[model samples]
Target: MSSASTVAKKKQTPQNTLSLHYLGDRVLRQPTKRISKINQSVRDLAQEMVQTMYAEQGIGLAAPQVGVNKQMLVIDCDPNNTATPPLVLINPEIQTYSPELATGEEGCLSIPGVYLDVVRPEAVQVKFRDESGRPQKMKASGLLARVIQHELDHLHGVLFVDRVRNDLVLTEALNKQGFSAKAVQPIKS
Candidate 1:
């Protein structure tokens, strides 16, 4: 098998489909605990998360979304291509961010069909441990930066909708998706 095929097989999640915990789920509001050690179980969990993300056609996913209260997240900016690879971050923390801010349409697998514009730093320097427990740091920009920030918010019990500036549009979008606009904990820019 080719390397890409090997990767696909390796990244596959659990046997049963991973169910996404929706926006109103209390699990989504609880802050995730930092992972102290990475092991086979953690690796397995991350694999399951990657599979769930791909199955849901999402670019990023957090441990909270899958009912796991751990600081873990998976991201693949180019999810359309298997060759692009994916990142599994455990206990990720942003060290610094660029002064430049950019607004982009953001969505969550947990929130399902709701999409809203959120403004965030265009670039970031982050530190985290890989799936194998190896410490790593990265400078991320563009879609990668957005995805990292978005998923990081999940680790802190913050949803993208909370960061949306326009309350009118946000309420309309969430209500249309059958989510209560009251659930949003807006953060002023």
Candidate 2:
């Protein structure tokens, strides 16, 4: 690599480049103790997660998606999916789920704008590590379910689009059902 490239890579914070959303360069983060104090470590991961999420124009992102194959993730539900209290799920595990199912338009930072109608539990109970590495569980419904399910799917190496439709025409019909992707171009190959 060139000297400038090396400097740029070194200068990259956890957020990464505002232009590179795939976070492909990031690697797996180590798991922390449930009771261990993870203020600095959590903060670093959170900052990087948000930076990567915003750079991709996504509402939420998981650590594994960016190559940090940990149980962590971040979510923002704004048009940019950038919310004030970004949901940080470290070592997150879905504990419960509603019997009700919902199909929502979903996409991925890793996969770009290709979208489809995917079915998921409309409500979910998730147990995960907090920013401090403490374990916590919460029941989520509505958009929260959608977000959590999307990230959790990543943990299993599943893409939201994969669960949804691959047929563009079917995808269009699903979008009419309120599954809108508003795709952005993938930054990495």
Candidate 3:
């Protein structure tokens, strides 16, 4: 088989389906935890998360949003998004964050087209583990940092909708144009 075919087979599987998709009602509302022994099952779940995130045109997705409620999450911000490494984070944690902040349009698969202007740190340093149970650390900025922060929030029972920084009514208008449910609250003197 060709190298492409071989690689495809490695990433192709049924567990690659979304565990909880589209504003998953009450199930997604529950909190997630950090547990021991994620194993292959967790790996499968992460795979499914990548597929689901791409399918939904999302930059990131979380385990709790899918009903797993773990510290696991995924990031595919390779710009081109080849999905290599696939960014399968287990028992993930953010070790450091930058002081600078920025506001950009944000949305989620669960909340659909609803989006809003949300402010986040301009950069961050995150620490997490790989599917193989190996520890890893990442420092990111720009769009990549934004995506990481978004997924990390999912693990902490936070949503982009809750992080909006602009007027809610204006956000509703933006959502009609395919935005998230909330906007970042602006800083005032």
Candidate 4:
């Protein structure tokens, strides 16, 4: 797998790149399949995903957001910092979550222009395969942890809006963004 640093961290709006699937798109709701084999194709996808994320000015992106049904995601919380490398996770599994929760504003590439406060574990321990297919375990917190959890949700056909607690705010936000509230499949706690 090529190093993520090889891709330019600076945001660019490239034409003909992967198009993001919107909230109401069926592709965003479809569950992704675990990658059985990681190869050049997978690495290529990861690279492109990173590019697409940068193009969209997003901090994280899941394969489902680009109409791909694969358990893969790319994240770069600090896109402007060339020193920081982007992350590519394949078949990520969260092993544990911190009992303490934090509430923060969350947004999705699939659900454009709708940001809402959502509560999630402040920290998480996760296992996944890197771009090179090597097993990796990581403990993430703060924005990185939030981004990981949000992207992981996409792999399971779940969006952050589903985790939102206040129906009125969610409805208002969705409506303001021109997305129908009916499209959201709320997750009952």
Candidate 5:
């Protein structure tokens, strides 16, 4: 292997750990910029995001959630398995989605303890760049699909709470969790 490749691989430790930006923070609302290049720095950030996700016991997280306004996210549905690696998506785009919709209980690391019911497509096809900067595409379903859609929303400055159909329940849950309901920018379907 090339020395550069070896160096990049060795730098994959969790040293660049970032703090989460909570709801009501303008950083979370600002749209993320597309990554022009996936270099070592970007890879390190992804590694740190993975560490933070595991530390927070979250299945998914976005760059904006970590106060980074870049189109990136990390997800690992099965955190218990060390053999399965976390998926790092850079400049991800949902190419298509299944017409069939399903409701799933969703939550955000940014919002902390608040969870709400969200309706989304049962399946999705997404295109993105891998950590190695290679173009990649895949179809996702079940928990993986739900987490992808949720994390992708963060790139567009959207939150899962925005998709909640019941305002009262959402507001109650947010309030109970010490979060403000006003922070949610609900998308009217």
Candidate 6:
């Protein structure tokens, strides 16, 4: 399997690529199954996911967002920087989160045109398998941590909108995007 660094960082035309499931899609609501095996097939999917994410100009993407039921995600916070490589995480698990909290506006490739503020831990320690099936661990902070948490939510059948605290903002954003407010299954804290 090719390394995640081999995937191009530049955006391509999204036509005929993996279709991104939207906010109301049932696929996005379903929990993803952990990838029991990390082979060429999983690597290929991760490569394609990275491509799709770049095409959609998204910082991160999950398997479920593309109608796959696997616990996998691709993230590249700095797509324009060729020096940095994108990350492919299989069966990612957050081991710990910092007590500090940060609120930031979040958006999803699935829920286009709707960005809302959601609070999340300021830092996180995560463990997962890389494309090579080797276990890996990392501590992340700032935007990287937020992206990790956001994409991880997709694996658990959750959306950033669900974590949104303001109903009026979420409803208005969804409505303006031609999406039904009923689609949001709010996660109570």
Q: Best-fitting candidate, measured by TM-score? A: 6
Worst 10 residues of 6 by lDDT: 1-10
Please give the lDDT score at residue 28 for candidate 3. Answer: 57
lDDT string, candidate 6, 9-79, tens digits: 44555552688999889999999998998888888898889888988899999999999999998999888
- Candidate 3 vs candidate 6: the TM-score winner is 6
Candidate 1 residue-wise lDDT, 49-142, digit = tens: 8888888888899999999999998888787665667888889999999999998999999888998888899999989888767788889999
Give the per-residue lDDT digits (tens) of candidate 2, residues 1-189.
Answer: 001110001112345432433412223122322323456765676667776676666777876666564566676665332123566776667778888989787766765554556778899888876665566777888887899888876665555554544556645643564444443111221
* TM-score of every candidate relative to the true structure: 0.92, 0.66, 0.77, 0.93, 0.91, 0.94
lDDT of 3 at 125: 84
Runs in model 2 with CA error above 4 Å?
Answer: 1-39, 79-83, 165-189
Candidate 5 lDDT, tens digit per residue, 54-82? 77788889999999999998888877765
Q: Which residue pairs collide in model 6, if any?
A: none
lDDT (CA) for every model shown?
0.84, 0.59, 0.66, 0.88, 0.84, 0.89
- For model 4, residues 1-189, the per-residue Cα lDDT tens digits are 224433334445564268899988998888999999988888888888888998888999999999899999899999888778888889999999999999999999888899999999999998998877778888999999999999999999999999999999999999998999999999998
Where does candidate 4 have its weakest 10-residue lDDT segment?
Answer: 1-10
Candidate 6 residue-pair clash tally: 0
Candidate 2: residue 140 lDDT (0-100): 80
Q: List the residue pairs that clash in candidate 1.
A: 13-48
Candidate 5 Cα outliers beyond 4 Å, as residue runs: 1-16
Candidates arranged by lDDT, highest first: 6, 4, 1, 5, 3, 2
The Cα error of candidate 4 at residue 121, in Å, is 0.4
Question: Which 10 successive residues of model 2 have the least lDDT summed?
Answer: 1-10
Stretches of candidate 4 above 4 Å error?
1-13
Cα lDDT for residue 104, model 3?
85
Scanning candidate 3 in windows of ten residues, the lowest lDDT window is 1-10
